[model samples]
Target: MDPLLLQVLAAKQIPSIGDDAMLLQESMVELINSNPKAGWKAALPSRFSNYTIGQFKYMLGMKKIPKDASLSFPVGSHVANSNLPAQFDARTAWPQCSSIGRILDQGHCGSCWAFGAVECLTDRFCIQLDVTISLSVNDILSCCGSSCGDGCKGGWLINAWQYFVQNGVVTEECDPYFDPVGCRHPGCTEVWQTPQCVQKCKSENQVWSDQKHFGVSAFNIQSDPQSIMAEIYTNGPVEAGFAIYQDFPLYESGVYKHVSGKLIGHHAVKLIGWGTTEEGEDYWLAANSWNSGWGDNGFFKIKRGTNECEFEENVVAGMPSPKNLNSALSGGRE
Candidate 1:
């Protein structure tokens, strides 16, 4: 690895504010600018050749990429409506979300579906149940079965929620799992203990109730994504979708100027809040699990309103409130 790249990675391991981290990231970018090929050689090896400097920098904190890195789609495919209410301004809405807490990213795995499902589950779980519990993505990743393939390839978020409904999830600790190796073990420490439903909900002609122990709803965004994002931030963390730019330029600080790049895949990230830059451009505050080093201490902002970074408008899945129960069946979207 290039000595300078190694230094940047080392500095990231320590906890720091997003602004400071951005500053260091800029310094690293400058180092690479001076020697492009050498820097690419050091920061991006074969395993990382598919990623740009920014993408590779983000991956340094993760153990490995999930299997579906090449299969993600951009958010532009599902924009439905665009009429905005008077109060909805990207500039203000972005900062509001950022102020609340740090955002998170889910890296290259299709486990994004898992993270997305769980984040909304956790947030709503806290609000509805009055309990602050970090539901286990590890449990879903480990036990949802072979039908969903291995964690790396990809799985539907709805399927994960269905698994949770029937099999009442255990704490993440009991499972201690990760993606690309979905549920490698059998026999959970705590068995899902609940009554079986004699009859399922018929709303969607599906055997499972629309009111399964946990349920998620999908929606389409027509206008400014920031408006919907504001709703999610106020309500709690939401599972928002985005296109992964493999070639996002790596800079230590300042606003991210757009560049053409490959659309590697789609990902689910936790929407903590929104914020704006000194110049008043809008952005959504996101959290990434790639570790604390990547993007503003495991967090970063996506441009709002450009249609490039629109998230909430493309509602992939909205988890319904979970009931206290045990064991649900697993299958793809109906």
Candidate 2:
């Protein structure tokens, strides 16, 4: 073992981790040594260096779309993308929105569900109005109601989207990331508890903050490649959920496809676009919240069409009212 590798394991307390860490490391090392044609490198990156698949679940933390929410709205038929271009990215469609290459870190909270929905909403809202404004993932995570799940214990992207339709999220300035209570906070998880809605925007001084944000509507995409792609082309990006594997944390870069890891847990993310690799492999670009230090600078590309990790199964999207954009234009944060 390399002394540096041991140091990382020690610093991260990996020695006393779950049963799969050692196995994942062994597999990754052997595969890398073999030098396959894959574009990305794999190893136990810091994000998954010390944690097991079970603990990783907290980071992914995406619950199922509530039956009521899914059924409330009549299902829309899957739209075909046959007429669409072979390649389309929200980043290029509306550069004015400035949503391209945007990544977010959820810190220690299992609020991927909130981050995904809010991120998509933020992008679409910005694209729709052609402006730049950072919406509040903290607001969504803390106050979206029980319907979104145990407030960071893991929630559904669909639930979060619906909540946004009823009541959208504020900006990061209004309610910053509340790691102490909003989530597990990176190094600790022994005292797991569901946090309550803090409603920080309601502060006496920022009394007008609550009125600055609004959710206009929400919808779900059909579980088909064309449907997913068409949704991305039409909007900005869509919130997606899929099962993750132990090998995911080690992803360095490239079009990722499950090679050797086993079932870890379900995670939610923002699906940006699709592309075929130089080697002709198809992939879906996604934004992750594990910070810029991990994965492809806080983003990852997974195999496309096959739903490599179910990235297309539970897709959700949202709309923000023009009222929110007006507030943003006026510098909503007084």
Candidate 3:
């Protein structure tokens, strides 16, 4: 079946929340309930659960209007043009000795785009400057302005990067703000403003063009997503996109096993590591944005190479080609 039609059919099967916030909360509950060994065993109020469910539904494009929905990335934008080759493995593409950090949860806000962009920047920052700084997603989510989305709504990853380049990001604690509230540093105290954020490229004269010139790398993954996952885990967390499974069973205990397709929404996660299931299907260890209570200590593993779980290959297309960045910034081809 066509993926879009299949997604619509699957969305109709899930329960509905009155609004987006409630929808996301519900999804978190389902995610936690799906994983029993993680030890989370508390039930949430219907109101709270509804928020998660709503967000999930809206993200999947099931809702006629989003509770806090905003603009999305341009259509056809992705990191890869194809799926990974069948022979790839996690050990080869990623460096072994890289340093990764703990996973984070964005919680109720469609700030995954910011989280993804910041996670990538943090990794590169660590590699380039030899310092591990957990930069603030709140900063970008709060400050990037209308081109992305409001704090309550969704945003674009490229816009977040532009925000980062124009205004250097600070530690989460330094700015320590949240959505609905935004940046609270009192003027530009903790903010680092680069000319890149709002500056249009001289040649292309596009806001996004300036972002292309920044030092970001993109790759296409096929075969073993575990390897790319490992690279993300070892180097630092990577922003990954996933299709939300609606029928993803509820977390009555904390164990999740796919029963049928009820998945909805397109979510971005931080890849932390990888492990094998009892059935020997490889799963990618991911950090969710649903607070610490969800998943295996705010983490979950998706079966690799099945469904749209292998969408990591598409991430390559979202990356700014090094060659493109150079040419745009240098006024000519490198």
Candidate 4:
């Protein structure tokens, strides 16, 4: 084993499986659970047992930008905090919109930038226009090209939203995500090449153009907790990009804080709501794209108000177009 790799395992307090075995979930769980002060629980998820340290790094693919990058999208609006609730959840607020609670898997791809955007937009369409549609994350990942980013390698969160407004995205029914190795399958660490952009839908009956949905506008929300809460309270869920630390993959439940480990990479998720834990820790609820088997059933709560993990910064969202919705139903005349 490389001495550097051994040092990393030592730093994480993970026992060596000997020889070339990298970090294993079992050792990580043992190390975490043994600590009485560890706020969150850890588990040995069999599905991720074979994941090497390198693969874990690639699993998260949300790119980072300068602090001033928010200027590109700008704050869409501000809301008064006078009536803000102590707790809120998008799933509860929009009970009819099943998309709000859906837990999607990026499936061995670093297309979290695309998954985060499409997931939030799918919920927004249901909340805004009362239309239920699973927008295609694949369309954004494979089709947006350089305008979005290097496909599964990583991408900008802002560009994903911008693509929704300018180019629009088709329904999942039209171009569903390609997952050959199911997310639940163990030892699935193969990185996928982005699928080629297919202009047409898989179902011959549905026209790709007619199945498309457009956004009216794309904007960022002020990083302040009140502002982010108000935006989701009124419009729906928003896409939040933040840095991921090595400790994050071990998260089970509790308001996550960077207790230990090094910076792994950046990742994006659907910022769905906020709440206060029984221990009085403030947290922002988010939906991750690692499927239901990870974290708190594909959901996580990170430290809120303080911008822990930089989750509050660079929040992005958009409005669905009623005009485009009607046009799609009639014909491709938008």
The numbered model that scores best in lDDT is 4
Give lDDT for model 3: 0.45
Instruction: Please give the CA lDDT of all the candidate structures.
Output: 0.43, 0.69, 0.45, 0.80
Q: How high is each candidate's TM-score?
A: 0.53, 0.83, 0.54, 0.89
Arranged by TM-score, best first: 4, 2, 3, 1
Lowest lDDT 10-residue stretch of candidate 2: 6-15
1-334 per-residue lDDT for model 1 (tens digits): 5546644653554333331123123334444444423212112222232333433333221112233641342221233334433233322444433322433334343466667666666565555444444455555655565533345445554455556555545433333333323222242111212112233232333333322345433332224665455445344555566565433323223333333233334555666555566667766666655445544555556666665533534443344444543222232115
What is the model-wide C-alpha lDDT for candidate 4?
A: 0.80
Q: Please give the distance, in angstroms, between residue 243's alpha carbon in candidate 1 and its true position after superposition.
A: 1.6
Model 4: lDDT of residue 318: 88
Per-residue C-alpha lDDT of model 4 across residues 3-28, encoded as one tens digit per residue: 35544554757432422344345556
Per residue, candidate 2 scores C-alpha lDDT tens digits across 74-161 of 3434555578676667777777766556776675568888888878877877777665677777777877767778776788777787
Q: Model 4, residue 294: displacement in angstroms?
A: 1.0
TM-score of 1: 0.53
- For residue 203, give model 3's deviation from the true position in Å: 38
Model 4 stretches with alpha carbons more than 4 Å out: 1-21, 25-27, 184-189, 330-334
